[model samples]
Target: MAAVGSPAIVEASFISRLVTRKTVMIGLLILVVVAVLAILAPWIAPYSPSRLSVVNRLKPPGGTYWFGTDEFGRDVFSRTIYAGRLSLLVGASVVAFAAVFGVTLGLVAGFFRRLDTPIARIIDAMMAFPDILLAIALVAALGPSLVTVIVALGIVYTPRLARIVRASTLVIRELPYVEAARALGVPTWRIMSRHVLRNLLSPILVQGTFIFAYAMLAEAGLSFLGLGVSPEIPTWGTMIAAGRQYIGQADWMTLFPGIAIILSVLSLQMVGDGFRDLLDPRLRKDL
Candidate 1:
C-alpha cells in the first residue's frame, strides 16, 4: 500500500471521496454556471443593467425583455446576471480576506496562552450581537460601498473563524508530533506554518464556505435596507428593494431577484454541507 502520508495517496483519496458525493457535484455544477454567467455578463447581457427606458417600465416577460423590466425599466435579466458578479465578488472576498487574517490571529492566540485571554474576550464581544446586525451597524458607520461592505462582513465573520481555528490549533499544539517538533528545536513559527497549519485545511475550508454564504446573504440584507453599495449599482438587494413597492403590481421584479439570492445562497450551503460531510472523520473512515 502507498504511504498514507504520500501526496499521491492524498490525491487519489480526494478524488474517490469527492466522486461519491452527489450533492457536492450538483452544487458545483450550479455554482459554475452562475460564475460563468457572471463573468460573461458584459457580453451576454442583452442590455445594460441600469439603462432606463420610459417605454419599457414594468414590462412583463415577453418580447424585448426576457425576465421583464423593473420599475425603472431596467432589464431584469441583465441586472440579475450583473448582480451575480458583485454578489459573488463580495462573498469570495470576505471569506478570503477574513480567513487569512483570522487564521493568523487564531494561531497566535492558541499557541500563546497569555494572548488567548485578551483575544478571546474581544472575539466574544464582537460575537455577542447577531452577525447581520453587527454588519449593518458597521456598514452604516463606515458608510456604504463595496469595500466597506467587504470590510464590514470580514470583521463580523473573523471572530467565528478565529474561534474555529483557535480550537483546532489548541488540539494540534498538544499532539505528540507537535511536542516532538518542539523538543527537536523546531522554531514555533516553522512548526506552525509547516506542520500545524497543514492539518487545519479541512476545517478552514468548511468554515470558509459557510462564511462566504453568510457574507453574500448579509450583503443582500444590508442592500435591502439601503446600506449596501451605491443605489445606482445593480445588486440583487437593490432590485428587491425597488421591486418591493410594486410587488403586488409587478411580482416578477422581486421574484427573480429573490430567486437569485436563494439559489446562490443555497448553492453555497449545499457545497458547504458536502465539504463538511467529506471532512468528517466517520465519513473518511467509510471512504
Candidate 2:
C-alpha cells in the first residue's frame, strides 16, 4: 500500500487549492470589505445613526449627505454603516452558536448509536416546524429583544445544522482511521474529537457559511416585523421598516438599505457556494 500522507500535508494542500480559486478570492474580498465596514462603523460614519436633524429630514443624497437622511432626519448613510455592524454581528454570532452547539450534539449522537434514534427524532420534530414560524414563535415567547432574537435564530438553525453534522459525522465515524484510533485504545471522546471531528471540519465550515447568510436574512425579517433588536438600535431591517412609508416620495429611504441587505446576503451565499466546492475534493475535481 502507498504510504499515507501526513495530516498537516493534506491540510496545506487543501489550503493551497482553496486559495487558487478565483471565486474564493472574490468572496474573501466581499467578506473583508463588510467586516471592515462593521469594525470601523463608529469612525467611518459621518454622523450618529440616531442623531436627528429636523432640517435635513428626508433629504435626498447630495454633497451634504452621501446616502441622504431618513424621515427622522437621521443620516441614512450613517445608519446604514452602523447597521452593517449589527447585521454582521447577528449573522456571525448566530452561526457560531448554532454550529458549535449543533455539531457537538451531532458528534455525540453519531458516535453513540444508542442515542441516534431519539436524537434524530427530536431534530426531525424541530425541522417539522417551518423555520421562520419557529423563529417567530421562539422570539415571541422569549419576548422581542436582541438576545432573544439571537437565541431564537440560533435555535431555529440548530436542527438543520445538527442534521448536516450528524450525517457527516456518521460517514466519518465509519472511516477506517476512526476504527484504527478506537482499536489503539483511544478514548471515545478522543477518537471523536481528534479524528472524526477533524475530518468533518470541511463540511462544517461550508455549512457555517450558508448558515451565516440565512441568519442575516432571518434577522432582517424579525426586525422588519418589529421583533428584533430595539428600535433605538439602528439595523438594516429596522431602517427598512421605518423607511417603508416613504417608499414613494423618499425612495432613497428604503432603497439603499434594502439593497445593502440584498447584496450582503447574496455575497454570503456566493461565498458559501464557493467554499462548498473548494472544500469538497470530489467537487473540486469536477470543477
Candidate 3:
C-alpha cells in the first residue's frame, strides 16, 4: 500500500520541483548578479560618480574610459554603477512598503466582510488613475525629494497590491482550513495571520518582485522629468535628462545609463516571471 504523505513531504516536493525548473534558476541567477552589482557599486566604480573632470568631457568609449564620459565629464561607467544602488534601493523600499501596507489592508478586508466594500471602492478609485500620473501628482504635492519619491511610488503601487492580495485572500478565506481555524475559536487576527497570510505568501512575493521593477522604472522616469531625486544625485534618469541635449554630439552619456536601467528592470521582470511560475499551484502540480 502507498504511504500517505505529510504536509512537510508535500512542501519539500514542491520546493524541489521549483528548484529544478530551468527558468526559475536562470532568473534567480540574473537577479543575483544584479543584486551583487548593486551591493558592490562603490568598490566596483572606476571613479566618483559625481566628480567632474572638465578636460575629459564628452569623450567616447576608449581605453581610458570604458563606457566613456558624460556631458559633465563624469565617468559613465562609475555613474551607472552608483545609480544601480539608488535604483535598487528605491525599488526594494517602495515594494516593501507597498506590500506590507497593502497586504494588511487586504487581509483585514477579506477577513472582515463589513470592510470589503469600502476598501474595494477606494482601491478602485486609486486604480482608475494612471500609475505615472498618480506618482507625479503625489510627488508634486509632497515636493521633490528621495523620501517623497519613494513614498509617492509606494502609494501609487499599493492599491494594485492590495487588490491582488484581496483576491487571493477571498479564495483562501473560503478554504476549509481557514474555516476550520475560525471555527476553533481562533481570533480573526490569528486566523488571518496564521492561516490566510501563510497561504498568500507565494502570490504576494511574486507581485512584490514585479512591483519592484515598476518602482525602479518609475523612479528613473521621475528623475528624468526633474521631479525625482535631487539633480546633485547621479541617478540614471537625471543622467539621461542631462545627456539629452548632447545626444547628437555625444551618445554615450544617455546610452550607458539608459542601458543600465533597461538591464536592471529586465532582470527584475525575468525574476518575477520565474517566481510567478514557480509559485503558481497549478504549475507546481504540473511540474
Local distance difference test scores for all models: 0.91, 0.87, 0.87
TM-score of 3: 0.93
What tens digits encode model 3's per-residue C-alpha lDDT throughout 1-287?
33459777768876787688777677677778767877898888878888899999999999888899987788988888788889989998999899888998888777779999999999999999999999999999999999999999999999988998899898899999888887888888788888889888888888898999899999999999999988988899999999899999888889988988887788777777777776786875565
The whole-model C-alpha lDDT of candidate 2 against the native structure comes to 0.87
Clashes of 1: 0
Top TM-score prediction, candidate number: 1
Q: What is the lDDT of residue 113 in candidate 3?
A: 91
Ranking by TM-score: 1, 2, 3
**Per-residue alpha-carbon lDDT of model 1 for 13-33, expressed as tens digits?**
877878888888888888888
Cα error, residue 280 of model 3, in Å, equals 1.1
223-286 in candidate 2: lDDT tens per residue?
9999998999998888889888988889898888898888788788878888888777788788
Candidate 2 lands at a TM-score of: 0.94
Every candidate's CA RMSD: 1.4, 2.4, 2.3
